[model samples]
Target: MLGRQQDEHVRLDHAVIGGNDLSEIDDAFDSLGMEPTYAGKLENDINHLSQLGFEDGSYFELTATLEPGQESPWWDVHMQKDAGPTAWAVEVTNIASVVDEIAERGTPVDGPNEFGRERPDGTYFEYELATLGTKEFGTQLPFLIEDHTPRSNRVSTPTPSVADTELVGVGAVVVGLGDLDDGIEVYRQAFDLPEPSRQTDEEFGAELAHFPDTPIVLATPLAAGNWLADRLETFDDGPCAYLLRSSDWDRTTERFSLTGESSWFDDRLAWIDSERLDEINVNLGVLSP
Candidate 1:
């Protein structure tokens, strides 16, 4: 059995972006100049996924239901509403030890459930996943993952275009909540994170904070009827955006057509123009590392 350490053992794995059409989501990423690798369909045949893989084994999992009106165990409302960042998972070295630690810290855990899938090339890979609480669709708390098969089999290498961009991996996940303090408390308790630095962004119309070195960002609406509030009403308090970390910030930005530049605390941030990502509600961001 693999042993585990504390929070240092956790790292950003992948953000699950759900949509109504899987193929359309693929085209959406392709339009952004990132090639999506088709992973495969779920065993239930209710969902399929394609991934935007990165250098550090992190990815953006673009997924959608295979059939309409069919309830998927993954998510119902988010998938129906084309919620971009519906859920997220962090990679851990030891599944059992981490689950035990979280449970001891007073958070409810549902698994280290054994899960696997077959790829298009007839290769198969498996992993263990555990929910932090009740297996709700858009829970603020992230799920945990550890690989049973070789991790490379599950996460593909980046294509040449993506490789040249120098994107390291997912840097942070932005979650929208009704109350920022409540969300912070939950994350702090679950992950043993320290008090985070806070700031309010007038341009984005939300007050956000980062949990030290972790990939979690908690945000709440600055006022009623703002974009964040609207997203909360639709997808509730779960992942709303994903920001990638780049090894070479200038090269990554020049490679893609970014709509505008922004800031995350002290780090420089840029956004992919939404117009380029047709039929996908996901907002993709890149941050200086």
Candidate 2:
């Protein structure tokens, strides 16, 4: 399952990177000119995820667990084993239906559970998710988001800093795993993503996956060898890739310098200045402290 894709597939709806290095993450933000919108917390049975706000509803989550006392899905495993991509959450219209569809194929799933961000009014925006698929699919299965909440009224408003804040979000995510080709096939049959081009490197391994639209791209290494490889090997086949955005690298990088530790990277993708990005627009919302 670690080779070129045979069919075409669509883009990823989003991507999530999980790591335990919060301080390093903060330091990475300092390198950027702006600051990260410190999203509070998302508590589940297994992981503790923190959201960072951006101009649009789009944001990247920082995840880890309190402790590995129990069998957990995210942080505990990541800390004990190794860091790697561990879930390919699909965007779906109906969580239950999607779960049923994948489960019929014998994939294990978790929620039509209500998940989302809390709006200023104290109302929460939510979406349903499916379970991770079976061992053959590498368990990259995750719930799809039918409703995506905009971070502000000016979600589309351009930022003065860039003068042209063109790039919206993660363009591609490169993942390193065991059965790259098999996972690619699962994405194709499930999401209808375009077939992908192939290549390989000794250190990185084989890659077979498609680039989703603006916002999220997914790539998987053919062989699971390094630290990243081990995570994919354990997390049951999810995200272990880096993100791509249609942004001016230099200007964005400069923001990293301006902001400080509010931003960070997981050796992949920039946690762009979300607070700064939203600052460009005239309208702002004040939620409770």
Compose the digit string of candidate 1's lDDT tens values, residues 72-148. Answer: 77778888888878898888889899989889888888888998988988889999989886437336888888989
**Best-performing candidate as measured by TM-score:** 1
Alpha carbon lDDT of each predicted model:
0.79, 0.41
lDDT of 2 by residue, 64-115 (tens): 5444344455445543442423333334445566667655655455555665
TM-score of each: 0.93, 0.60
**Error in Å for residue 31 of model 2:** 3.1
Score candidate 2 by lDDT: 0.41
Query: Which prediction has the highest lDDT against the true structure?
Result: 1
* Distance from true location, Cα of 57 in model 1, Å: 1.0
Ten-residue region with minimum lDDT total, candidate 2: 280-289
**lDDT, candidate 1, at 128:** 91
Per-candidate alpha-carbon RMSD to the true structure: 3.5, 10.1
